[model samples]
Structure formats: structure tokens, C-alpha cells
Target chain A: MKQSGTIVEKQYFTYGAAPDRLQLESGAVLGPVTIAYETFGTLNRDRDNVILIAHAFSGDSHVAGHYPTDREGDKPGWWDFMVGPGKGIDTDKYFVICPNILGSCMGSTGPKSINPETQKPYGLDFPMMTIGDMVTTQKALLDHLGISELRAVVGGSVGGMQVLEWCVRFPEMIRSAVPIATTMRHSALAIAFNEIARQSIMADPKWNNGDYYGGDFPRMGLAVARMVGHVTYLSDEAMRRKFGRRLQDKEAFSFGFFDGDFQVESYLRYQGSKFVDRFDANSLLYITKAADYFDVVDRVTASGPLKGGDLQKVKYLVISYSSDWLYPTYQAKELVQALKRTGQDVSFCEIEADCGHDAFLIPDERLTTLVKGFIDGVG
Target chain B: MKQSGTIVEKQYFTYGAAPDRLQLESGAVLGPVTIAYETFGTLNRDRDNVILIAHAFSGDSHVAGHYPTDREGDKPGWWDFMVGPGKGIDTDKYFVICPNILGSCMGSTGPKSINPETQKPYGLDFPMMTIGDMVTTQKALLDHLGISELRAVVGGSVGGMQVLEWCVRFPEMIRSAVPIATTMRHSALAIAFNEIARQSIMADPKWNNGDYYGGDFPRMGLAVARMVGHVTYLSDEAMRRKFGRRLQDKEAFSFGFFDGDFQVESYLRYQGSKFVDRFDANSLLYITKAADYFDVVDRVTASGPLKGGDLQKVKYLVISYSSDWLYPTYQAKELVQALKRTGQDVSFCEIEADCGHDAFLIPDERLTTLVKGFIDGVG
Candidate 1:
């Protein structure tokens, strides 16, 4: 799936045992995992400046630059602003690697992938994945790169969950970590959003028990789910500011159920429709489930009963956006509070950005400065 | 349709010629309409004290008391708190009339009703309806009751739109109007919410173009739609306050997508599934479309061509909730501004309530007191 692109390289790698031996939390193991990754900048002499970037829902390994084999009208990848040289993540200073998560459709092993045993798509039968499972696979990738330690780990939203997971699951692997606009645990409200999206997919008759590979697929359900998730990604103020009472194309109502009467309707429809062409509904289900079930506190708490995790050994910089209602500032505060309780060396900054949860993906001078300064201080 | 054992007597009247024909803004006449109304208190000789209560989405004519005829576990009525004796509307002083709107399945001539011309349910073939059409039918119902004027017309959310429509459609018919937790128009953001809900319904394969009457009837779509609407009804703060990150039953992740991993998920699913048993998907589509097309600002700014409608002359009491992101206080302010600009007698009230868009249905003493005092002052 490598596309020759300017400025960044998109690539893939194999890690661990074959698909039949990948291990599970419940003492089950099945493997042969493939990872789709995009790399920016060059690794240092000691290969110690590596920074892992995890993609969120609907995200892929194409974190920055134009996909080498670009098509007209292709979307600039979700985090393109942050990964380019001289940008927030600064590919010029850091070796950045963004990998499509285990349960995604961006060249990763998901429901859309073929089942070696049956010679058909895995579909619903694909083993349910957890955030820990995703991190464990990333560890395998790091080992393949001969990287014994990472300078830092950074992510936002579900990606932020992965950053936190890295801090817990592989504390020694990361010197500093930044989790932006993310929750410590998936809130009931958060899980509700994912469940509704999953229900929307399964409800589609064309989903065909996740076996609609050669047909129309459940594009409508997938679109609707994306629309729902899109609403969460935006702040109410941002929505109102952008398209309050704005008409679509006409001055008056058509008085019929058709294209759109309001600008937001047209915007959402476009979002939903465009999403289906590049996304798999089953991957949406699997990835959201993975994020919903992710909890760093619970995992660490279980190991040493929530008392023995020494966070002082781990330097943390938590970033939250003021207008991000999906994962509000208080959730970040909660994370800070729990980390403090665990006696961690933690610093928190809530940036007053109005871009909502997507702020983490955009280029904010303040954020860029803070991140660069924090990384320098940790080094 | 009138088998009732409640505080008030049920009245059924055939108003339009077609089962669901209510006149639209295009000078189109809709007929054969049926209205189910519950009138509380006497009409009085002059019928000046009649107050019309427009129910919100999924509401019925039963405004108060448990109907002996109602099935077990069903609600008595949505607005029982505001319409009973000494309540906000004050049944002791005002003759309150709550009517099931024309395009609803609750004893009104909707898609579920038999089209006398074809002797089968109208289903998708039913003429499309607008908020104006609903108001027109309600006016006819009032005419059948021999009420020459109403002291007030009151509603919340979608019902609030009806209240505004009553004033705009028949300014002379209503002396004062209270529209709560609603806007002068469905904002682009609001329309987006409704659009996703409608898309959720239409996407369900079992919908089969709204002809699924006897067999499987898009329950999944309806449920998903309701779930989408439910999220909008509650504020982020409310959800955080109510559910937080609380797990449903087990303290740990189930690692499977069975059900009820979180409390909010269970609550939303419950809200959705419970709604499917009584509501019609076609009605959902029609009512949402009506809401999306409604805009009082269009009436006030006819020269500017906002929506192009005749602005009715009536006093307005526009009420909004502080925590209502769905229809925030800013929207209500827009309504008041439009009415003020049009030289209409409009008073605005911003009620401080923790409840989101559903605040009007809940008994906030401040809101109820403000409403009662305003109604009395207008009278």
C-alpha cells in the first residue's frame, strides 16, 4: 500500500507470530499482524528520538503530506498540519511514526482483511481488539525498528488513549508522554456514542452480519454513524458560528424531504457520504469498541491494586482544549488528579482553543511552543 | 379514540377532507384530517380564557392524569406537571386544550391511518406536512370546539415551534404566546440533528419506503434515530453529571459488544427501544421535516426572503434554558430580536435550568412561576 509521496513516506511492516498466534488478555493468542505506518524525518544515530503517533477513529497511517499516489480531491490526512516539518510535531526535530491501529481498515488487519483460514473477510468473526492489544503490536513494531526506547509518545482523542496506554503498558519505553484532549477512561457518555455508532452499522441489512464485502455495504449506516460522531467532534459554539440558520441553496423551504434546506444538513450529508467511500463500517465498530474498553487506570490498578504504579518515573504533559466538549477539561483534570494520587511528575495545560477536539490536529502556535518546550525540558 | 378515564374528557373531531390534509404555505389545501384533543375546564362564554398547549415530539393529547384506558407502564402524559390544577397553565383559570397534531400516530390522521380513498394506510403516499400545516389543522380543531380566541398558546422545543406558528398563522386567534426551549427557526445545527435522525430511519432496510406496516418495520432505524435525538436532548454537563464514567454492571470491561457496558449506553438504548413500540417512522420524518422548515424570522423578514411567510401579529413570551445546547439561550434571543424588529410585543425570559432542551417539560419552579406570572400579566 506504499504510495510515493513528497515529504513523507508511507509504508507497512509485519510483526510477531502469524495470525494464528496473536495473544489475548483472556489467555488466548492469535497472530500474524500487519501494521500500516507513515514515517517522517530520520531516526537519530542511537535511534532514541523515535516518537510514536497513533491514529484515531477514521484515521489512517497517512498522517501528513499528500499520499504519494494522490488522486484529485483526496482529503489531506487528519493530522497533516501537526506532522509536517516546522509544524507542531516538527518532523524536522523528531522521527515521527503514525501507525493505523490494529482494528482499522487503512491497510491494517480488520474485518475487511481476508481470513487466512476461510479465504474470506474476517467480518464479525474478527477477534475483538482492546487498546492494550494495539499497544502490544506497536511494541512489536518498535522492536523490529531496533528502537529500544522512545523519546516521547503523543496522540489526541483515541490516539490520546494510546499515548496513555503507552505510559502504563510500556512505561520504560517512553521518556515523556503527551495525551491531548482525551479522557482517562471511556466515560459512560463516550461509550454511548460508540455503541450508537455500532448499532447503526449492525442495523443496516446490507451489513449482512458484517459480510457485505462484495455488495453495496452499509454505507448509509456508516454515514449516519459518522455524522453522529462528527457532531461530537464539534463544539456547539463552533457549529452555531459556522452555520446558524443558514439556508442551503434556496431562500425558502422546498417543503419536501430532499437534498437540504439548511447548511448544516448539506455539510453533514457530505461528510457522511464522503466517509463511506474510504471507510469500512466494521472497522468503525471494532476501533470504537477498542477505545471504549480502554482504561489506563483500571489496567494499572489491577496490576498493583492502583497503589504501586510509580508515576514519578514517568514525566507527563497533558494538554486539553477549552472548547472540547467531547473530552472536556474536567476529564483532563481527572487524569491529572489520578496521576497525582499515584505520585507522578505531571504537568497540565488547558489551551483556550475554540477548534474543539480537532484543535489537537490543527497548528496552534501556543500548543506548538508548549509541546516543543516540554519535550526539550524532559530531554 | 375517545375511550378515556382521566382528569379531562377526550374529544375527537374530523377537520380536514383527507385523513392527513392540512393546508401548506403553498396555498395547498390538505383535508380528511383528524384531531384528538383533551380540553380542561370550561370554554367560558367568550372563549377568551382558552390556552392551547402544543405537545412536543412523541407527546399525545393526554396532558394530565393517568388514563384508565392506558396500557400498563405507559406514561400518563408528558406535560402533566404544567397543566394540572394550580400548575403553570392553571386549569382552574384557563381552559387548556392539548391536541394530538395532524401527522402524529396518536389518534391523529397520520401515515398509520387508513386513507379513505385507498382503504389502506397512507404510509409514504401521504402528503408531506409542514409546521404550518400542523398549526392549520390545530386551528381547525379549535374552530370545531367553537373557540373564537385563545388567551395563550404554549409549547416547548418542537412544541415551542407550534406555539410560535400559532401566533404567526393566526395572530388574532392568540393574545399571547410562550415558546420555551426553542428557536424562531430550526438553526442549521438543529436541522443537522434532525437530518441525521431522518437518515437513520431511512437507512434501515426494513423501512422499505415506509410501507412496513404489518411485518418488521425499521425498528433499528427508529431506535438509532431516537438515540441520536436523545443525545441532543441532554446537555454534555447533564450526561457527565448523570452517568460519568460509571460502568453498567461489572467493574471491568467485558471485551465483547453484548450490551450495557456503561450506564449511558443502557439509558440511550432503553430510550430508543421504548420509543419504537408507539411512534411511527414516517411521522418522525414528517415532524422532523416540519421542524427543519419552520422559521419565524422568515416571516418577519419577508422582504429579505428568509423563508417568505406572512407574519402574524401577536404578543410573544420567548423562554429559553441556560443549559440547552440544542436550543440555547442565544437562539431564543434571536427569536426575541426578530419579534422586536417586527414591532411585535415580545418579552424574553432566560430561565436558569440544569436540564437541557427538556427543561420545559420538567418542573423548574422558576420557569413555572415566570410562565404563570407572564400569562396572568398578559391576561
Candidate 2:
């Protein structure tokens, strides 16, 4: 995994006997696909000191310290603080592993991955994937890494969905589980936000039915989609406090309407433009659909409504932020309450924060202390 | 002077001693402006029964009832309830005159109107206008209509700003005044919304620096701008109630992001698309800027704040909607409280409604009843 100058390690593995076709919950079958992954910390002999972090949409396995060759501008990793030495999770003490989920553009088998039989990128013809399929793929990756158990499984938002998946799919595998700012079932409002973002991407004429690999990308629609998503990520109060009605340059109003007068407008435009530079539009659609399909309790209690679920083997830790409307604290409370009714060890905390849905990404001393204390208590 | 189809008798007049040169508050002048108006009912012998209804940003003299040549889809006017036969300010009694405000495309001499000197659209060369200049133009129109005294000057939002202006600039002319759901000064958030909308319009490449006339109009930018404004016109709860997570055509998710999935996205896109067909981009820019500059109290209110003097001669009524964030109820309360402080007869009511800023347009019996009772009580 070590290299000079922006090292992006790409490794591959074949999981299970390649079936003629593996059917997903959505009834789409994918066959004989290779999965890509990149490893970080070394696994201990006991394999019990492992932390499994799941990637959200548009994220990859780069969850901590930069590759030796990474350039200055490229972000080292999404969760640099928690995984670093002496930080929240502490890389020195615990082995950390993050897998780029299935149906993602980041070092994983996705729509862009070549179909072995056709030897071409599986564009729209790529099999549709459910959140369960994504979790199954992660399970395969963990098996390949020779890790049968984990100290903890931790994630936020869509990442939180994966953490829940790990618990239900293999309850004994996880000693502790932390699902932050996530929902048991996607709300109508949440679905609407995702649907709008998806439509914005799809409406772009440049999309060319998801096969525009060599041509100009659907930048405008993708930018609009990102703009919509970014709005949900930050609170209105946060935006007002940060930018307000401050102007870009001018004082008096320009009679002609051809300039940015307010700082908020400029900030949104900047956010949109920069997002299209790094993210793939198709990947956004696929990942959002995966998130939209996530609902773990329905499977666990299909016959009858579950007052609680079996969490005796798993010490559950749920966290939420006050201002996060995207996945509010109430959703986190539901999970904790469900586990409580099941007579399981569960701790839920709602943190006061102004960052909205993205609060989980920001370093809060209180949040870090809670996470560290909860994980240590589990041991 | 009433016809079956005609709402009111159309009237026009020329004033401002330097009739060829219209002087502005900023000491600027444009030549030979025309004002179009319509008067309902009849003026009293004392010329004191006249009530002036100030128009909003894009509104015209056609504030109530059917226009002489109004087509099927076109509304009678924005506020038909508050001014009609047996209505709020009953046309059978009190004389109500609503004039097309200056700097508007509708009948008023604006950027779209031909410049007498150049025989071309004023466009970008038109001098910037303030709220004061608009009130001044209205005064001249009132004088020509042979009304020395106004029983009341009533308005909401930008119209409310004009009502305040009339009270300040010509206190002797108004007997009673109503300024509803408006503020004497714009908040930073209000300014941010307007500025972002302007930026959305200018961002479109086809704007051609506001000279796209007789060519492909800047429809994309204009549509985007309208979409932004439409969002402000609606409360979050209203949007959620109307469009929520309802899917457009499909039941299951379309993994590809090309088509509209959610009803809200489709609704917003439809609203945006239809807006461009009816509205002129340049007019939108001008009108929004006018609204942004409409502060009754000057920005730097150091010692004595700007106030409408001698409200003893005027009775004031203010109305606001519960969910109207664009022009909140607090603003109407402020206007009413200010008038009361000056020992004026004032009444204020906040309507309970979910539609937000555009609630005034909806057919609400309470609004009609309250307005009618108030007008009759004043009479």
C-alpha cells in the first residue's frame, strides 16, 4: 500500500465460486465479478482488535492517513482523525479496515467495472444492487482479509446503514456497533431529496443514457444535483451565519443582473463546481439508490412488528446531531429504543451541533470522547 | 363608468412640472414617463373616499376583477378579493384606485418601454430606480386622477413599502393606511434570497449581458431564477405536504438517474419551465432589485429613525400569514406597533395558513371577511 507520489493502491480478489448469476433483492443478477480493495493497518494475530469502517456514497476505502505519495491538495482520507495514532479510534491500538462498497466507483466492482463475458464496461446493463448486496460484498472482503470478528463497526449517515447491515447479517462478528445519524427506514422527505438529486443528474443531455464515458460529462445536471445535496448537508442557520448577505466585491447594486452580489450564492456555486470535478454522476445515482433501499428492521421482523431485536451479542452505540435534518436525532433514538426493548446493551446520545447532516464528519471533542469511552467500555 | 368585462375605467395623466424630465430622489431624471391606472367606484364630493392600492413588484393596476381583455388563463388581478363589488373595499361604495407602478413592465414606463429619445427599449441604459421614485410617480398619478385626499393607502409586501412611502411623502393625502406582511427594512436573509435569484439568472450563458431581446431569450437562467423564487414562496411544510416522496411514474427505483423520480422534482421543473414562457428575464431582474432597495428606514439609522409622520389622520390595518417566511407576521406587527406608537388607529391580524408567502392569493374566506368588515367599519 506504500508508494511515492499519490499512491492509489488497487488490489482485487474473487469471492466464492462464481455463480452463473447472483440474484439481488431487486431481482437483478450479477455474475463472476471481481472486487477491488485497499488495506490500511496491520491485523493482529487475535483478529479481535479490528475496527471495520464502511464507506458512504462517493467515498472509498481511504479512511485514514494519506498514502506516502499523496499530493498536498488531495484529502488524506475521509476520517483522518479517528484512525490516526492516539486519536479517537487510535490506529496504534486497533487495526482499521474500510472497504469500498459494491456498486461504487471507488476501487470496487461497479457499473464501470468490466463485465468478464462482454469485456466491456457494464453501463446501464450493470446489475442493480440493494443495500444488502453491498453488505454481502463487504462480508466477502472481510472473509478474504482473514478477519472473522471485529472490535467495532462504526459509520455515519449511509455509512450508518452499513454498520447496521454488519450487525444483522452477522450478529456475533461485531463486539460493538456505532451507527451515527442514520435511519432505520428512509423517510419520504429523505427519498424526495435523493430523487431530486438523481433527476438533476439524469436530465442532463450529456448523460447519454449512462454510457458517456469518452464524452463530456453531464456537468450542469451533476452540479445542480450536488448543489441540492449540499443544501441539505448544511443548516440554513449555518449558511446564514457563515456567508450571510456579504457581497463578493461590489457595494451598490449592479443595475444589470450579471454578477454575484451575495456571498452565499457564490459559496453554493463554488461548492457545485468543485463537486463535479471529483465525483462521478452515475456513481452518485447508484449509491443514492443503495441508500434509499436500506431498511434493516423490515427483514428482521417481516412476519410481525418487532418491539425489539436481538442485540445481546452487540453493544450498540447510536449518535445523532441536533441540526441534522437529513437524518435527524429522532431516527437515532428509534434504533436505541428498539435495542432497549430487546433487553440489549445500547447507549444513545444526541449531540448539540450546527453543522447539519455533515456534523458526523467534523471533529467535536464531546463526540470523540463519547465514541472512545463507549468503545473502551465494550471491551 | 363600468362595463360588463371591464374591471375599472382606465385612466392616464401627465404631471411633474418638468413633464419632459421626471426627477428622482437620487437627483436623476428620465423624460416623459406615462402612468396607466384604473379607478373603481366613485370619489366622494370631498375627494376623501379614495383609497390607493399600491401594487407589488410585478403587479399592475389590474388589482381586482376582470380586465377588459383578460384571457382565460390570466387572473383578474392578484388581489381580487380585497377590491371588488360587495368585496373588502366594495366597488359599490368606496372609490379604490390601483395604478400600474413605475419601473414595471405592465403598462408602466419601464426598461421594456420605448425611450422617446432613442425609440428603443431602455434595457440596461434605464436609470436605476429606488422605492421613493416609485412613490413619487404614484403621487403624480393620484393628482391627475383629481384626488386631493386618499381615504386609505393599502398594500402588502412591496406594496406595503409603497404604502409606507405614501404616508411619509404625502401624509396629508392619506386618511387610513394598511401595510401588511412587510418590513420597513430588509433583513440579511431577505437580501440573500433576492441576490441568489439574481445570480441564478445571470449565470446562464445565453443572457447575452441582458440584451437577448429579439434573439434566444435567457430562458434557462430565468427559469432557474423563478424556481429559486418559487421555493421562497412556499413553506417547507407546504412543499412536503404537496409533493413529499411521491414518485412520478414508476413504482420501483430506476437505478439510472435520467428521469424525474419524485413528484417534487417534477413539480419544481414544471414550475420553472412554465415561468420562463410568461415572464421577461430583464423585468424579473429590475423588479427584484426594486424590492431589495425598498427600505423605508435608511440603512444607517443613527439618531432619529425614518418614520411616517402624523398618523393621527390615518387608520392602519396590517395582515400577515403564519407560515410566510418571506414576509413574516412579525414584520406586520412591527408596522402596526409603529403606527400605534404615533397614536393612530391600527389593527393587525396574522392569518393561520400553510401555503406561506403566496397565501394571500389563495381563496380564504377569513381574509375576505376581515378585510370587508374593516373597510366598512372605516367607511
Candidate 3:
């Protein structure tokens, strides 16, 4: 239950520096790619006690604890409950690192970052990033730290895709993997939602084809996209239990065009508007495009079963939430099937939770126990 | 297998004339309301074979067959599959009436209609209309036709809500009722989707506070709203079976921000853009607001077991689809429970279909048979 104690410092590693640019999946090159990352605890002498935690879509490198500042009740890092001292991952025993994924605006080289050649923000000019590209940057950061083999690679939602990418692209670096509440690829329904979110962004004239860097932002479009994200992240049961037909302060219907004040409406609007301040619409379009294009099943199927490496060397623990219709439990099982077909060591569990895809981010006794047990068994 | 034969003419009836305005639930008054409706088949001498078919959200009075236009490939009516001469609500036997609900852009007097005082589009000035007002208009139309409802009333989705309103508000006017794929009230999840859809329209700059009647409409916002609606209307299974992860025209990923071209994306965009062409943005806001405000359970409970009406006189048929998550099967069952508690004769069936909320509108053998059998049992 203890915090990570002192705030972790966010360090940056600039790869593909200068003329030698990082070759993206689209055959385009991006240079001086800086990946923002933060690490808790310490790397062991063997450099084998590392656990990489990938962030979700629109997430940053700050995974746990707060930055050193003079503030009371400041919000802690995103996964503080699961990655702190004596917590599920036990930062005191293992070095835990989280890197901001590519195609995101969270201190990473994304659409908002300056193009080395043009000297302007990439905006729509940024090459589309893939999950493999994201994992490649993480591996680059690990190599820089002299950390070769990770004890485990863990992540949920879009972050989980990174864990799977690491499993296939660089299995030698992972002793174990935890891909939680994510799919090898998006189903058509998921694609529909993401497409709608993207359309919402593109529809805003303020977006100006993603070139609105210093002027008015596409606040409305980005907010709508975030609202769609929020709706998908939580399950029907969660919303039903949380808001139900509850109105705001008014006892009767507003009956006016713009003042119906349903509590859920207020919550979604707040979530959307707040997201507008922290996110870039172009980044959302790029990141979601990347996620929608991801398909681990094809890559794994093509690679064949684990190659020459021993199946026991790389372990995978697939976790899914029962109520996560966005990335339903069946998808996790599909992922498990794909992994097993590759002859990789795989363990699967469907956690009974009503919070939907966001369940892994929330603290639960069963989840903590399962994660701790898996980690303890790993190293 | 015959069509409705001749395309029925849309008829209009004016009621709630000026001076005596229709008092809305919000205490706002609207006057000289005009209800646009269409009728097929013939009313028997006893006026006892009437079957009122309410249309869904964004639907119109044209319930069966095509228009009077001479196009060879013209599309049929919205419910043509189930409302034709020899189909479910067989026009050959029962008199069928379909009324476009109030607060809609389709023929009915709505936000797009000219306000008497302003002599311009009501726009945001249009008073909010509820399911009750919609049913009230239909009742007025029936009175003008010198017909007393006897055979049955049928509808699905938002239309289903209207059907329920008619049951509780005018049980004495019915011999039976059919409400399909609907809820007595919206769940918080449903409310969340509706609220987000409303926000999408309101966020558009071209909306101009709903006064963009003679200028550029909020096409983008309205399209996004339609996209959201499309997502909710189809089931995950349906989407997966139809589109999967198929790409459009391209063999590989576009690797660009906007050209990923997942088939699902193409479909949703088309659906959204097409909706913008036919629908009024302000009407979506008002109609969804009214649907959100509807709570038949409260009104039904207050009426106390049909107000001592004969349980066998007015029968009820509640139908739901297996994969219609928007309304879901449980909501229909909930309506059944309430109807039974009120001592009204009720029959319930959950049709197994993977098409989601739109299943009832599509041609299905089981649904047609059920409707035919229920309507036959009525007269």
C-alpha cells in the first residue's frame, strides 16, 4: 500500500538522431525521435529484473507516483495503485519502466513534434506509427539502459498491443508477458467506433486538415472523440450503476433544446472538455489509425510457432475483463489461441469486472493477487 | 408477397389550434400542430380493424411500398417488409395507419416547420415534444378519420416507446398493442449515447444555435451524430460478420492519417453523410431529448393496473431481438413485467437475431409470423 516514495524523473532518449532517421512501417523516416520514459526502483546487477509497462492510447510515460511539486491532493500517476512499493508489480523489487508510445503528444515525437527538416510541427505530415514502432522505441530505451532481458512486459488496452508486439518482434527480451483487455486486432465494431471518433475530429473545420498548430484548436472535434472513447472504455453496467436516469440539480426535464442536464451528459461533457486541453486531435487520428491497423494474429501466424526458441523461455499471461465489450473477453481468448498456435507459453484468465476495458487500470483485490502471483512466479 | 399496390398519399390533420395550445410536459405550449400520417388498406364498416404502426426515430409516415414517383429502382418504404399487402401487418385485411412523430423533420410539424409568430423555421424556438405529444397527435388523426383503434398498434425502437405511451395513455382505445425492441425507459448507457449524439450536433460551428435554416447546416456535427446512431443500431456480431477487418481497395495499410480505409470506416462515413442529407440537426436533438425524458414505468405505475380496465379487452405483445443491445431483450421483458403487474393481457417474445436494434425493421420470417399471428388474434 506504500507509494513509490520520491517522484520518478522523466528521462528522454533521442533515437534516430540526425540524418540517420527511424524508418517507420510506412517506409517513411523520422529523425531525432525522442521517447519520454520514467522508471521506478532500480535495475539489478544482472539487468534482468526489468518490467516494461506500456501506456494506453493518449497515455504518457508517467506510470506511477507524482512529480515533485508543492501541491496538496495532486493526482498521482496513472497506474500508481498497481506499480508502487509493495503493490501488484512491487516497484521495490523490480525496476518498472513506462514509455510514451509513438503517435502520441505526451512528450513523445508525434504530430505535435517539430519536423527536423521543415522546422514546423509535423501535424498531418507525421508518418503513421505502428505498435511495432512503439515497441521498437521501448526496446531502444532498454538497450540504452543496459537492460537486455525483461522479467515481464505488461500493459492493458492499446498498451497491451505493445506487449504482444514485443512478444513476437523481440521474444528474447521478454521472460513473460501480460497483455490485458486488448485484442490482436480490432473487430469491425471496434473499427466502427474508432472511425466515428476520427470522423468527429476530421469534421471540425478548426482541424484545418490537422494544421491548426498555434491558432484555434479543434476543441469540439477532439472532445467528441474523447467522449466516444469514454463511452467505450466503460461498460453498460458501469454507466447504469453510476448514473441511471439521475438528473442534475433540476427535478424536471429542461424541455428546452440545450438544457436537459442528465448527470451522465454532464460527466461525458466534463470528460470530453478536459481531454481537449491535454490531447491533440491529429495525434488522436494518427494513434487510432495505428491501433485499427494492428493485427498480431497475421504476424504471429506468418512467423510460425515460436521459431527455434524454447517455448518455455517466453511466457504470456492474457487477462480480459468480462464486461469489456470494446475489447471483449473473446478477443483475449482469440489472442491466446494465436499465441498457443505459435507454441508460446500462454496463460489466460477472464476477470469478472463491470468496469469494462478500464478495469485493469482500477485497483481490485483479485487483479492485484493474480498479477502479484504471476510476477512472483516470473523471477 | 404483393406490395401495398398503390402508394398511399400522406395525409395531414391540424389540431391544438391557436388560442388553445397543446400543453407540453415541460409546461411549454405549442399551437396549431399538424400531424402528417398515411393510411393503407380499408377501415371496415365497424371501424374495428385498425392497426396503427408507429415509426422509429427519424422515420416517416410512409410505412409501406414506394412513393408516387415513377423511378423504376426507387427504394420501398421503411417498413415495407413487414407492412405490405400480404406481409406481417397485412394491409389486405387490417386498416394500417403510420404517423410521423412530432419533433421530426419528415413531413410532420417540427423544428423545420414555420412558426406562426415568426413565419420562419422554428429551429431552436420549436418547443420540445415528448412521446405523449406524439401519441396525442396520432389520436387526433384517428378521431378525424372517424376511426376508433381496435385491432392493434405496433412499433419498434423509439416507435416502440410511442406504442407504450399509447397503451398507458389510451388503453380504452385499443384492442391490443405491440411494442418491439424497446425499453419502457432508457438505461444510463442508452442515455449516455443519446447525450453524446446531441453534443456532437451542438458542437458544430455551423449549427449557429440551430438558426442555420437558410444557410450552411451543421453537416459535420449531424453526420457524427448519425455515425454514433449507426454504431448503436448494429450488433458487434453483425458488424464482424459483415465487414470483419477487410480493407477497402487497398491491399496493405495506407500508412496515412486518413486513408487507412477499413471497410467499416467507409460504411459508417457513408451512413453519416447520407443521414445529414435527409435529417434536420435540430430535430435529432429534440427527438432524442424527448425519448430520454420518456419514463413509461412511472406513468404506467401511476395509472394503477390500467385504471381498472378489463385485462382481456386490451391485449399486449412485447417483442425484442436477441442482439439488440441498444434496447436489449431484458428491457422488453421489463415492459412485460410492468404490463402484467397492471393486469393488462401481455405476450412476450425475444426473437433470435444478430442484426441488433434494426432487426425488427429488416425482413425476418419469425417476426412477420409473430406480427401476423398477434394481429389476427386482436380483431
Model 2: per-residue lDDT, tens digit, B116-188? 6677777776777777788888888877767788877888778888888787677667767777667775654
TM-scores for chain A over all candidates: 0.93, 0.91, 0.96
Which structure is stronger by DockQ: 2 or 3? 3
Q: Rank the candidates by DockQ, best first.
A: 3, 1, 2
How close is each model in CA RMSD to the real structure? 3.8, 5.1, 2.1
Candidate 2, residue B186: CA error in Å?
A: 5.3
Arrange candidates by TM-score, descending: 3, 1, 2
Worst 10 residues of 2 chain A by lDDT: A299-308
As for candidate 3, its clashing pairs are none
The sequence of per-residue lDDT tens digits that candidate 3 reaches over residues A1-379 is 3333658778888889867888888788888899999999988888888999999997899998878761567678888889988999998899999999887888888999999879999988888888889888888888888888899999998999898889889876779999999999999998888888888888889999999999999999889899999999998899888888899789877777566578888889889999999988998998888889888888766445446444435787899999999999888988888778777678899999998889998989888888889988984
Docking class of 3: high
In order, the Cα lDDT scores of the candidates are 0.80, 0.72, 0.86
Cα lDDT tens digits, model 1, B1-379, are 4334345656788865754555567555556778888888766777788999998877888887666566656666677767767887788888988999878989888888887778888888777787777888888887777887888998888899898777766776778889889877776567778998998998888888889887889999999999988888887777878887677887876666666677888889899999999899999998888887777777654422232445455777888888998888988888888778766788888887666888777767888788889888884
Q: Candidate 1 falls in which docking quality class?
A: medium
How well does each candidate superpose onto the true structure, as a TM-score?
Answer: 0.91, 0.80, 0.97
